[model samples]
Target: MKSVLLLSVLSAAAVSAQPKLTLKVHTGKGQTGYDVNSTMIAGEKDMLVIDPQFTLSEAHKLAAEILESKKNLALIYVTHPHPDHLFGLAVLHQAFPMAKIVALPATVNAAKTGWPARQKFWFPTYGNNIPGPDPVLPEELTEPYLTFEGERFPVTGPLQGADGPGNSFVSIPSLKAVVTGDIVFDHVYFGVPKDAARENWEKTIDQIAALHPAIVVPGHQGPGATDDMSAVTFMKRYIEDWDKNAAASHSAAEMKAKVLAQYPNLGMEYTLNDRVAAYFPPAAKGN
Candidate 1:
């Protein structure tokens, strides 16, 4: 009886020493919001969601998944200020009122300042699929890292990414995983606006690669994309291709064609359109 009791105690101790956190990703459909990835990092009793969704309906679906998990929703961390990453805060807040939604100060400010313009621009296209006028914005996160079940998940950056600047990503050391906001994308066209600094963005990708994370949850990915270093490799190659093609082409259409020919199967062609337009806007009518 004593030997059995000793073995039972040893089993419990081993279980207690194991890592308590696990991660699950909920990716949007390819046609919906460019297959944006929203990850749920769950501890033994509580969980944290990173980057909600673009549409209210999709957010509802994400909320349902969280509900099914049966873990307390402790926090929601917005990775960047883009509407696609943050527009669903209202739905999530309504569903999990107790969860504290937070982001870096820069992200919070950009979201608040860009909300009106973003709503005006996307409302017509999304039509009632998005949140109404008064959406819930995340509070400014003052801490350097997030804590879940006594483990530290460090928040790094405000660095330049495909979406421009003020982009932050979260790292789980125990998991050797990084929840990259727009810093990385898997088999998806990048959103490179007019003001984007390609050099800086490349540097950011290098920084992430240096970490050698096993799991990389990008801001966007194609269907069946794996969470691995392949995304980082793709991002670097895509940026190099963009630079080479952009320099060779005389018009936006030419640039688009070149890029498309190179990455014919990549998702989010709309992003490529935006990228070319930003780099090669049509010449003035008089010219």
Candidate 2:
């Protein structure tokens, strides 16, 4: 009996000594840039950041949070190439120069090639709020997963997302949590651009649901969005509604009206207008 008790105590001590992973989320509220989420996965002595912010001010705030955590910033993972998700790389890189910033190869390529146009399009409105002329891109990640303190955070995708292709998510299997890029949106209008494939996006969401993640951190969220399966459910339902409404409506205006009626309280109505307009442009003059 004494031997058994000694072994049990030893096992408890071993479990207690193991470093546990915790998550800290920094969400950019609506006025700042659509409430993009930046998640920090912290271990005992080190942490990994997923998806930096859109504006410089927000990024600086995120950096301050990281500093206060008292954990070494070891790795930074960008889930996609979108400006809102990765434009803050410069701020983070400056703050933690020794940390490695990485993303899937396709994402790296897209950011490299798309930076010039993205800058031009957003600069006029965002002005100096965004990153400067010299963009800081992430390195290509060759490995299938990210590692910190002996644990693996699996990287999935280049999967079909609302923003089109070259999107990815990082999954923490032990925690049953996923840091989804624009693949998921909480209480915001989905970015269904002209090139976006609704069917493919639905399938991708289905795949994510299959993982049974307890915590679902969306790339964009609203004021009081929670990190859970609700985002996944919301995206799936929203897409279904979009498909149904789009098919019945004759014009983008009609479609937008129908969707709004369904989700009147949803934020980012501009995104809905922009996407529908791309789908149904005005008739050529004098035709």
Residue pairs clashing in model 2 are none
Number of the top-ranking candidate, with lDDT as the measure: 1
Cα-lDDT of candidate 2? 0.85
Candidate 2 weakest ten by summed lDDT: 190-199
RMSD of each: 5.8, 4.8
What is the C-alpha local distance difference test score of each model?
Answer: 0.86, 0.85
For 1-287, candidate 2 gives per-residue lDDT tens digits of 99999999999978876438998799876656557889999998998999889888899999999999999999999999999898888899999999999999999999999898998888897888887767799999999899888988889898987777778888998778998898888888876633347677777888888899999998888755788989877776876788788889999889989988998877666567887776577887987
Candidate 1: tens digits of C-alpha lDDT, residues 1-287: 99999999999978876767899998877556657889999988999999998888888999999999999999999999998899988889998999999999999988988988899899888889888777589988889898788888999879988777888889998888999998888888886533447678877878877888999999999854799888877776777788799899998889999988998888776667777887886677995
Candidate 1, residue 80: lDDT: 91
